[model samples]
Target: MFPLFAARWDRSDLTASLTLFTGLMALAFCLVHLFVGQLRFLDRNPRSRWLSFSGGVAVAYVFLHMLPELGANAGAFHRATGLDEVMAESAVYLLALFGVAAFYGTERALKRSRGQDKDQIEQARPESSVFWLHIAVSSLLMFVIGYLLNHREDTSLIGLALYFFAMILHFVTADFGTRGDHPELYDDRGRWILSAATLAGWLLGTQLSVPEIAIGGLFAFVSGAIVLVVLKEELPEERKSFFLPFAGGTLLYAALVLSEQALSA
Candidate 1:
């Protein structure tokens, strides 16, 4: 699909044009959840299946694209920062590790504060402090995603397209899970606010001129954030999931990513 449009990828104007599309898509992703009840077929029995499938694609993307990119970026980060060779090579992984730990720690703290298993929390539970915490972190992550979509000029158009597709589904799954937990609280205003944050981030990224090292760090952080989010949503023991859909999503996106890498290589 990307190949068919390869020749049309005009570098000078492509990012500018696509930024608008990405922003609109991000906004739409958040808005879609308001109609969740009407979209039962996509959210029905074995509710975690959709999340699992999207999570699988997201995980595959992090492993196949982000990790390698970060590995390469770490060498540059080391050189730029004048660090010891070994330390420089480890920069990306260290940042990613902290990202993972931060997310895990946040979840643990939120759960402990509530004194109840989040996985078992019913819709009737008041939007606890944990709810606002989730909103804040999710907003931050969404903003980073919006920023990345516009700022990653190193990625070819096709690469961004694939990432966009996976992330859109990822957002869908995540938002659905969020709405489930805060049925009455995650209202239209709240949804619009989340969506606005994304657009604001995208607009800001377009105007900013950050360095390569900073961008690399952003990718590492987002990779960790994405991993925790998808896994947490899809892997709880109480949730029913379809393995075939999960595996199929994983393999399908993996194949696409591999093909893209092969062509570039």
Candidate 2:
């Protein structure tokens, strides 16, 4: 009886440790956007190599980890939803495509807003309505990220750490881009709202339980958004981003991920 009780206590302690780690990671996610405005060094004509490096890391995670996970999750999604195998298999990818399209549409609208507003010529901020629309979408993404802090399929510490690093870098790049687009508004209200959305997501995840299929779908959407946002930030001609750092980051992360998989296998 004492041995059984000791085993139960050990399991309880492990659960507590994991819960604390996830909560702290969620807080870090909230803090990244809340204070990302201070990273003014990234705002340069000759673009920051760090941003390119971050983009590379994000791309690596999406392609190597998240996309493969989506494929693996497809079978479970099919089983849960009672849909045809083909439709269920393809559903997550369709959600990912929609995520890309949604962000692209918002990007075009922001550009249009800037172009039409001659009065705000110097600042080049998007109009107020458009700014909120962009913020809403961005915040939704943040919320999903925060929710996944708890719901992520990999409950191990190493898995959570990798997720945290990939996402924190992605957040920095995203915050930089949005802050540039809405210079006045992002710092004033946008970052605060995003930070809150992240916290809100964590709170919801703690309080409410959702189906695994729904969580998988949200994960796929975020994977798509991350890919689009990273490319949009890096691929602009005027940014003059570096290639070496980007390649280095990609190779380094890929090697680490592959090694991790090998060790686990």
Candidate 3:
């Protein structure tokens, strides 16, 4: 199905059918991660690692094997078409927003069945620095995979697969590290806004070919800063457990960004 789409449409010197497919898969992976994370899959440190590994493998397989072949044949099959990058990005953003809304709806339905309290939804259980470390490592992997996919004109299918695999792993790690107490208040509007913003950021990063480090760093900084601010208002007993992942994610994002900047310089 993807190949047929590639054969019919996509024509950038660099954008092959495989590349498009992989890119779409990457977006799908992100959405899945977001959904699962929201559902509290990474509540435990060990489980986070497993999820990260599984996600990474899934992403890597698509990038390494699927992308390269499509890229190599990109020119022979399709002619360059001046499709709007902005429009495409917008579409992805919209998709992400929709996904979040759908997830929230599902969650609400589940809560009704379980008789969960509207104001006291259980937050993500806390984990050790080990979990944070895993997240940091996975983020680094995302940087590498993004870089490789963006820079290479012609990559092997195997290589693309590995890259995507690493990316999913990275997401799992981040998801694990940042598991927080589910908010007591279900703010549908707030969730929708955040989802839209996240999707926009994601689309911009991919469309602009922003360095992976920069993108990751920005995510880390923003998410960490939000967490830290939230902690300031929490009870003393609640502060300790939540801080590590926020700090770790922030540090990792900063490190990756600085490292990349330095190397570029």
Candidate 4:
């Protein structure tokens, strides 16, 4: 028999291991933002199948895992916030709606600032103030994701692994999308700031603990934002995205996630 495997687990050892693992995952996220633009294969004009596949994986994660978890956490939100029954039931979802609307509005603002004409919009960079505003919003989102890595609803090893994988693919798509919008600004300044924001969030998570309701709210908002980002990237006409890889990635990750839930159940 394996004595160590049968031995009782120590709480301190488990905590230390989790901390080390999540910290490494956080670093991986930072690296992805910093270098994703350099992935020339994904920079194809016709849109790479890999890019579509990554979007599929991200979308699958949001719809399959995060949204359902938000519903399950509704009671926690009610108890923590002391809201009315109706408000408690709808609060998380309302927050999700707000997230989607906010990002959509920001995109519209950036486009309008570029110019009214399509050709002018394509060639002109967003105004300096607009570009910085976009970066600010994106950095805030990156911070939320990094903080959640340490304080996820499911802190089990497998849960963290699933979250990390989904978010990495999501980041690839997000970074690429931003680069398409502001190639020079994103490369010179935006990526570095976003990368730093993620690390800063991880650093804060190590130092602070918040109410579970607040964490759940952040998670829900992120889920909504992710849906918008994925759809916007994959649905555009010019991207010429492939459908087969997208569907394949979706089915593959969905099966894995559902199987994990069943085993844990």
Candidate 5:
């Protein structure tokens, strides 16, 4: 449902409502998967299933929640000021999708490069430098996208940047720590970078005044860090197994949803 132009942007109540709706939808999606585990049918492999379910929820949010709101708001905005919402909204979605695709693509590439056959690698490798590279590329893409949006004068660009950077850095840090071949010296460096990234995210989010997105980003960062820490201790033998990657995928999905919220906000 779209709102009508009233000759000026009123921050359409409908847009605001949609933002809240999408946020709730994202939270619900995560909680339901965490608790009910109904989507296990989507994939036979447990880890793959988790990644798919999480990714599915994120994709749904984009199509069902974010895109709809953009269409509605864009319609109203265009009617009132002769601006094109379709192109703007499309750009946002394209950038978001590109980030996700890049992460997955890079991950797949890494798995292949590691002498892993497609099926075996999916179950075997958990944490790898290639995987972390995927995260870094995806994160960097978010920053680029944010810069583009800001250059275009998108009001929510700053919030979007904060949200994307937080999650991206979280993944990057986790990946860095989990790399099986990482030099011991790099561990401390990785941790320091992660700490700085988290602090920077917090400060940026605060300065930008997007509390909701900030909280979401922090949640992702904390969750990722906890996963990496636990994995470092528990899976010493199979440090490169599917466990960590699965968790990373979940975090990436969270980041996507948060980015959507920030952009829409």
Candidate 6:
């Protein structure tokens, strides 16, 4: 939790400013969905092609852009921290894997608890008082995501835009998922906690600057979580995913990412 506040934004750096602006806007867009969840047409279309497209775009970002960037960051981590080269590389990848597993584990636990609560209420058992626990845990995870987005400086406006597009959809699905599990809690307190936590994380991340290695590693961790959460939404057995739209989104955004990298190269 070292402060990264010293690296003040240079007003001349328009690209950074614009990217930062878009990042803020994207967070606002997600926050809006928490209130307007059911009002959207997409909510009715759970299997909407847009979901698959967004999932695909998200998948492409992690695999093509985030992973490669993390590989380089791992190398930097090795140099900056003076870790063993092989071990640093291994650790970096492991962090990504760990992110995926951690998110999956959390989601599973939450879903199970939600189910038990529902069942207990049905049986007329005392209503589960674990609503605050869910709000806390989900808020923490989302806070990390917002913080990591602030750390993603390597991305250009276009890349961030695509990322923003994907995550907006990602949050929408997350809202629906949570609502499905605990309708009352999500309606009353859960969404507010998430919005506050995420916005707070972004504000904190912007104000505090950490070491390069920490930034790189944190970004890698978020990448892993992104992959996990996106795939969970799109690749479940019960959910019907539109394959063509999915692939179309995957290829289109993958090409966009690769092309940008190529141009910058």
lDDT of 1 by residue, 1-265 (tens): 4464342344345465576666776666656645653556666665656667887787777788777877887776886899877887687878888778777876665556645755555424543667777777778777887787765644565676787778877877777777666666676445665777777777787677477788788878888877887787778766676778788889989998877766655
- Find the number of clashing residue pairs for candidate 3: 22
Clashing pairs in 6: 4-208, 4-209, 5-209
Assess candidate 3 and give its lDDT: 0.38
Model 6, position 245: C-alpha lDDT score: 87
TM-score ranking from best candidate downward: 4, 2, 1, 6, 5, 3
Query: In candidate 2, residue 154 scores what lDDT?
Result: 64
Q: Model 6 — TM-score against the truth?
A: 0.80
- Please give the range of 10 consecutive residues that has the lowest summed lDDT in model 2: 3-12
Q: How many residue pairs in model 4 have overlapping backbones?
A: 0
Using TM-score, give the best candidate's number.
Answer: 4
Query: Poorest 10 consecutive residues of model 1 by lDDT?
Result: 4-13
Candidate 4's residue-wise lDDT over 174-246, tens digit each? Answer: 8888877888888899999999999999888777778878887888888778888888889988679999989
Candidate lDDT scores, in order, read 0.71, 0.80, 0.38, 0.82, 0.38, 0.68
Worst 10 residues of 5 by lDDT: 1-10
Ranking by lDDT: 4, 2, 1, 6, 3, 5
Which structure is stronger by TM-score: 2 or 4? Answer: 4
The sequence of per-residue lDDT tens digits that candidate 2 reaches over residues 1-265 is 2332122212223366566777898888778788887887787768888988988888888888898888877887898989888888799899888889889889888878887665564367678899899999999998988887777766655666778888888888888888888767888899899989998898787666688789888988988888889888888775688898788778878887876565555
Can you write out model 3's per-residue Cα lDDT over 46-83, one digit (the tens) per residue? Answer: 33434433433333333333333333323322222333
> For candidate 4, what is the TM-score?
0.91
For model 5, what is the alpha-carbon lDDT of residue 261?
Answer: 54
Which structure is stronger by lDDT: 1 or 6? 1
Those runs of model 3 whose alpha carbons end farther than 4 Å from true positions after fitting are: 1-12, 38-41, 44-149, 152-154, 181-265
